[model samples]
Target: MVNERDPDAGTEHWLDLGPDPDLDSDPRHPGGWRWWSLLVAAMAVAALLLTQNQRATHPLPGTDPAGASVTRSASVAARPLPESHSPPRRTGSPLSGQSLSGMLFGASPAPTAVEPAGAQASAVSVTDLGHPLLAVPAGWELFGQGPGIVVRIELGRGRVTRTSVPEVGSASPIFFVVGHDRAIVHPMDSVPGYVVRDGKPATQLPPALDQAASALPGPDPWHLWAETETGTATALSLLTLDGRPAGVQVPIPKDATVQASDRAGNVLMFGIGGMYDLRQDGMHRITGGTLLAVGPTRWLTLECDESYRCDSVVIDRATGARQTVKASLDAYEQNAGAISPDGRTAALLQPNGIGASTVHLLDLSTGADRLTGVTTSSDQTLGGRTFVWSPDSRWLFVTNGAGRVLAIDRAGRAISLDVHVGAIDQLALRTTRR
Candidate 1:
C-alpha cells in the first residue's frame, strides 16, 4: 500500500528490514566480505609457494621437460673418468714439431701432453742395471735374464716368473718365440732347437729341426714355426710348445730366409729365388726383393732399382692381389717396414745413411705417409735393432741404435723408456693373454 503510486513507496520495504544496523560503523572502513576476500587470497598464495618448493627438492626422474639441459650438464661434468686397460698417459716434456709429410717439410706442433702416471707409475726404468734385459708387459714378470736369452713366465694372478737360459751366449744370440708356458730357442750358431719352460729345458725338437735358423710365434699360442735347415735345403717345421713336432714339414729353398709367418701359420720367405710361400709351396716370382712385412692378410716386399731405392709391393695372401706403394726410400737397407698387428698402418725407416735413421708412418688404406721425426741414434745395421708391435696394434716398441727403448704410437708420437735392453739381436714379445 505504501508504494502504490510513488517511486519512494518501495524504499520503506527494504529500509524496514535492515533498520540501519551498521549506522554506527565508519563509512571509510571496509566490510567483512572485503576482509574475507583478502584472507582467501593469502592462503592461495601460500599453497602456490609450497608446490614450487616441493618440485625443487624432488626433480622429475627422466629427462627434463623444462629444456634445461645446459644446467643438468653442469652436474654431470663433476663426475670421474671411466676405466680402461690402456697405458697411463705421460706428462713429460712435449714432443718437437718433427712430423714431415713429404710435400710439407717443417714439423707441426706436438700434441698436448696426457695426464701423468701419478700413483700408478710402477714401470721402473732401470738404466743403472748391468743386465742387458727387457721387462715383460704390465701384467707379467721377467722370468729369467741372461747373457743372450731372457725368459718371462706368467704367474696365475697377472704376474710372471723370470728365469735365465743356460748355454746361450752373446757370441751366438738366441732367436726364440714365446708361447703359452714355453719358448722355442734357436741359436744363430750351432745350437740345436730346444724348448724351455720356466728357464729349464722342457724338451728338444726332432733331429729335423735341430738346425733351425729362425723360430716364429704361430700355429696357436702353443705352437711355433721353426725354419730349419736340412743340410740340403731349408724346411718349415711346426713344433708344439713342448718341442714335439705338430704338423707336416714344408720344404723351402736352402737359402730362403723366413721373413714372417701369418696368423694362419703360413710362412713367407725370401731368398735368391725371390719371394716364396712355404705353406702353399708356391713361389711369388714377381721380383727379387727382400720381404719387409708380413700382415694377417698381406705380405710386403721391397724391390730396389740400380740406385738402391726400393718400391714396396703388398700382396694379399688369399687372393694374390698386389698393390704397389711409392714413398721416399732410405736407400740404405733391405728390410725396415713393420705391418701393424691390425694390418692398417706400417712403420718404415728411411736410414739417413750416416747414423741417424728417420722413421715414417704409412696408412695402408690411403697410401699417405707422414714423417714421425723419430730417429735411431746408430747406423742402420743388418740386425741388432728391434721393432715390435704391441698386441693391440696401436703401439710399436723400438730399441734405437743409442740403446734407448721407445714406445711409439701409430701417430708417430713417442715415449722414451729410460732403459737399455742391450743390442737386441733377436727380440720376442711376451704374448700371454692377461
Candidate 2:
C-alpha cells in the first residue's frame, strides 16, 4: 500500500520539472518558440558567411592563389633597367679613344706624332687676317691692335667682334700678353699698361718700364719679356703687368742689345764683340754675326766671308753645335731671314744681281736649296719685315714693293690673297687655343 502511493507522487514531481501544460497558451510564451527558431537561423547564416570569407582569403588547390598574383606584380616592377650616361670616345684625334672622365680627371692628351726632320709638311689652308673684318678662326683673335683704337678682335661664328679699349688713345700701338682668359696690354708709348679679363673692365698695370723694346709675350703666358734701356746699359728685363717679375733681371753688356727673341725663352744678344745668350745667371757668348732670327732651339746667324758672301749658321742652344750653310742671298741688302717653325727649313730672299730678288728655301736637315717663283724688289718689305713663316711651317706669307700679298707653299706655288686695305704693317699667328 505504501509503494503504490509513492509512484503517483513521483509522477507529479517529474511533471512539475517539465513545461506547464496550461501556461503554454499564455501571451508571454508567444515569443519564446520564435526566439529559439531565430537563434538557429542566425547560427546557419554565420556559418555560410565564414565559409565565403575563408574562400576569398585563400584559394583552393589547382586554382591561382591571391599571393601568386601579388608575386607576379612585384616581378614585373623589377624587369626594366636604365641606360648609362657616359660620353663616347673621340676616335682619330690626337686624343684618340679617350673618355671624357679620363680627360677631365686623370688622363692627358696623347702627344701628336711629329714628322721626321727632313719630311715635307702636308699642305695647309691659308686665311688672311686683313682689314675690314680681320676674320680668323673660332679660337683665334688679333690681340695686338684694333682699328684706330686699342681693341681686341674676337673671331667666331663667321663674325668679327672688335672690342675697343675705351680707356686708351685711338692711335696707341697696343701690345698684349694673353693667357687663359686674361690679357695685359702695353701701349708701347709713354702711357701706362692695362689689364683686362674675359668679362671685366680695363685696369692699369703698375710700374711701367720706359723705352721697352723687343717684347715677346712672355717667359710664360702670364709673364712678359722686354728690353729696356737705362742710360748706357740695356737690361734684359722680365716683368708682369702686376709689378712682379717671374725671375731676377739679367744685365746685358754695355753696348749689347736684344736683336731677336722667340716664344721659347731664348734671347739673341748682339754687341761690339759678338752674340750672347742672356741667361738668368750671366751672358753666354754664342757667335760673331748679325743676329737674324731665333727658333725654338736654334739661333740663325749671318757670318760673312772674304768674298762679301754671307753664310747662315744654325747654332743649337743646348749643345753649342753649329751648322754653317751658305745662304744664296744678296748679303748687302736682305741679310736677315727666319727659320721655319719646325726648325727644319730656312727661307731667305736672294737677289739675282739685279733689282729683283727671289725667295730661297733651304732644307737645313738635308742642306738642299729650292728657289721659289716669287719675285720682289730687294728693298721690299713683308709685313714691314722680310718674311713670316706660317706656324705650321708649311707656307710663307710674302709682301712685295707693289704691296701685293702672296702665300708661297712648299711647291713654290704662289697664291695671291685679296687685300682691300693698305699694306699689312704687322702679322702674327695664333698657334694654340686660348
Candidate 3:
C-alpha cells in the first residue's frame, strides 16, 4: 500500500499494492522506490523550464497564426538605397550623332556605299566619291559630257548612257535637254545653236536666236529667255522651245545682270546700286543685296562689306519680311548657295581654303544651321559649277568640277555618283515637254 495525502479531506489514505519479494529483501534501504520517484520528478521539471527559455529567446513571427503582416518597430524599419548616377548607353543606329530633324528626315548614321553592277571600270577614288546612302529619284536624267561625248545618267536605275557627238569637238558646250531624245546644243562661243536628236544634229535653231549671247530656261519648262546684244544695247527676248518668239524683247540695263528667275516669270537683276525685279508689267527696284538664290516665294541674298565679310538674309517677296540666317565666318566672295524649291532649306558652300568647299544647310523656318558632312572640289563661282535641285525638293545635285556629281538631301546625307567625265561645265535636270 502507498500512502497519499488528500488535502481537501484533511485525511491520510492508503494506496493498496500486491506483495513483492524484492521489496522484502531490500531492508537496508527503506522506502527506496519513493527516492527513485523523487529523482524522476526533478528531471521532468528541468525539461519543462528549458523549453520555456528557448521560446522566450526566439519569439514566434509577428503574425498571430494568420497571414497578415504585423507592424515592426521603428528601429527595425527598411530603407531604399541611393539613386545611381550614370550616363545612358548609346544605341547602334548609324545616325547616332545626327540631330532629331536629320533622323526624322531619313539620314543614316553609318556610311553606305552602293556600287552599280558594272561600275568597276569607271570607279574613281573612293575617298573623293563618298558612299551612296539613298536611291535616286525615278525618271530623272542627269546630262553632262567630256570632249566629243555626251554623258547621260538614268539616276533611278544607276545606268550611264554615252552618246558620241562629234560636233561637240574639244570646246565646252552649253546644252539643255528639251525632250527625252533631243536637246539644244551650242558651243560656248558665237556659233549658232542646233537641236540634237539621238546623238545627231537634227536641225538648226530659228534665225532669231542666231546671235543670242546666252539662253536661260524657265519661269516654266516651255519658255526660254534669250539674251541678245546688239552694239551697246542688250535685250532679253522670251522664246518658246521651238525658237518662236513668245514675248516682245524687253530692254535690259547696260550694267545690270540677271541673277535668278522664278516660275512666275519674274526676273531678278542685280547691278552696281542695288537689285531690281522685272515682271510682265514693268521693272521695279527692290532691296540692295547680292542675290544668291530664288524660290517661289523667298529669295536668298548676301550683304557684304568692303573686306567681303558677309551676312545671309532670306527675304519674303510678299511681306518683305527679312530673316537673317547664320553664316560661317569663312563664307566670303568665293561662297555659293542655293535655296530648296520648297523654300524651307538653303545650301551654302563655304570655301575651305584648300581648294575644297564645305556644304552647309540652313532651315529657313527655324533658323537651324547644320553641316552636311559633304565637301566638294567644285568651283564656287556663279557661272562655273551648278547647284540644281530636284523638282520634289528632296535632293540637291552638285558638280565636283572633275565631271562627277554628288547628290545631297536636306538631312545632310550625301552620295557620290560613280561617274567620271573630263570636265562637267554645266548640269541641268531634264524637264518634261509640253
Candidate 4:
C-alpha cells in the first residue's frame, strides 16, 4: 500500500538502509549515499591540511621535496652525535679539503710523490758548513812569557769555555796544537807542559819532558819532538802525547831550534849555526835560503835581497823541483804565509798599507797568484796576523786585531763569527784529523 512518509522524520535512519526509490526519484531531497560521500571527502581534506602544517613547522636538515633549502626551527635544538658515529675532519696537505666519505670510497685523488733519499740533502749549499769550533787566546800574555789562557768558542751555540795553562812560565813562547777532543799548550821553557781534554781541568804533561828546551809537532798529532840539551850536547827526543819517550833520540846540531817536521821523520831546524835538515841518516845544512813552511813532499823557502824584499820558492824534496811563487806588488813577509796540508797551495798575507794586509792564494803547481779579497787589520803589536787552513784545505780561518774571527772559503765567500773577545793573541781551529 502507498503510504505518505515524512522526509525529515526518517532522514537520520537512512544511514542503515539502502536508497528508497521514491526518494531517489523525487529529486526533492538528495540520496543518502551522496550525503555520506560528501562527509568522507571533508574529513580527508582536514587530515591532509594538518599533515602539511606539521611539515612546515619543523623542517629536515637537507633540501625539501621541492629541491629548495629547508631551515630547521630554532626552538628545536640539535644534539651532537657520539664521537664513534661522527665523521673525521680533514686536515694537512694533499687531503685538507677531502671528506671522510669521499676518502672511504674511490673518489680521492692520487697521493703526492715522495722525495728520494738524500734529495733534500743535495739542496744544501756548498758554503754551508755546520758551525765550527774556534779557540783564541784569552789574555794579553806575551807570546813567549808565562802561563797562557785559552778561550774556546762554539760558533753555533755562542758558548765560551776558558782553559788555563800551568807549570810552564812566561819565560818561553807558548804554542798550541789543538785537536777535536784535546789541546796541548807547550811553552818553550824547560818546564812541564799542560794538556786540556774535552774542556776539563788541564793536567800536567809527563815529567819525562820537563827538560824540553823547545818542542815541535811531530809528523802526527799524537807525537811531538822535544829538543833537549845535556851539557853541550843537543838532541831531539821523540815523545808521545802522553809524555812517554818514543825511545828514538837523534843527535842534532848544538843551539838548533826545531822548525817543522814531516810525517817521514825528516826534521828542519834553524839557529845560530844555519838551517839544517835532520834525516834518518844524518844532518845536512840547507844553504842560500831560509825555510818558510814544510809539508809532506814539498817545502817553501824565502830569499830576501839587501832591502829585505823577499821572493818565495816551493821546492820538491823528492826531485829538488823548484817553482817561484808569482810575484805580487805588495810586500810579503816570511812569517805571514803558510803551506796548505795538501802541499798544493800557499796562503800568504801581503802588507797592503799600515796595519792592513791582503790575503793572496798562490798555486803551487802553476805558480799563479790571485787575491782572496779578504783584508785583515792588525794593531801592529802582534807583529803580523797569521791564518790557518782547514785540514781539507777548503777554508782559511783568520783573526783581526779587533778579535773578530773570519772564515774565508775557496770561492772568496767570507763569514764573520758573532763573538768579540778583544785582542786575540793567538787563534786555532779544532779541526778533524785528515
Writing each residue's lDDT as its tens digit, candidate 2 over 10-119 gives: 64322235564445555757557756776776667566757766776688764444434332112111111111111122235333555444554468666543323321
Best of the candidates, TM-score: 3
Best by lDDT: 3
lDDT by residue for model 1 (1-434), tens: 12233466544342244444445666776365556676776667566757766675666766343434433112211111122211256443222232323113344556655543321111111112233233435443323223433434231233232222334443644555666666566655665545555434234545544556766666567777776656677677777655577865777766666665443455656678576666645545534777665556566777778898767777776687878876544343445566777778877777676756777777777778877777765322222335666667877766564545566777889876544444433344565542
TM-score of 2: 0.50
Clash list (residue pairs), candidate 3: 94-109, 94-110, 95-109
Q: After superposition, how far is residue 47 of candidate 2 from its true place, in Å?
A: 98
Clashes of each: 6, 0, 3, 4
Q: Ranking by TM-score, best first?
A: 3, 4, 1, 2
Model 4: per-residue Cα lDDT at residue 70? 43
lDDT-sorted candidate list, best first: 3, 4, 1, 2
TM-score, structure 3 vs. true: 0.58
Which run of 10 residues does model 1 get worst, by summed lDDT?
119-128
lDDT for predicted candidate 2 compared with the true structure: 0.52
Alpha-carbon lDDT of model 1 = 0.54
| Sequence-dependent TM-score of model 1 | 0.54
lDDT tens string, model 3, 1-434?
Answer: 67899999999998768785357546897778767776776567556756766665566787422334454211111111111111123443333466444444466655444333311111111111232223655567676644444556667655554544334342433534344455555554565455544434235556665467656554565667677775789877777766688876778888887654443355666776887876655567665656665666677777777887777778887788888777543353322566777889877776678977777777877768778877666554423335677778899887766767888888888777776655665566674533
Can you tell me which runs of candidate 4 are displaced by over 4 Å?
A: 1-148, 152-160, 165-172, 179-181, 190-193, 260-267, 271-274, 279-287, 303-311, 328-330, 351-358, 371-385, 420-423, 428-434
| TM-score per candidate | 0.54, 0.50, 0.58, 0.54
lDDT of 1 at 247: 60
CA lDDT of each candidate? 0.54, 0.52, 0.59, 0.56
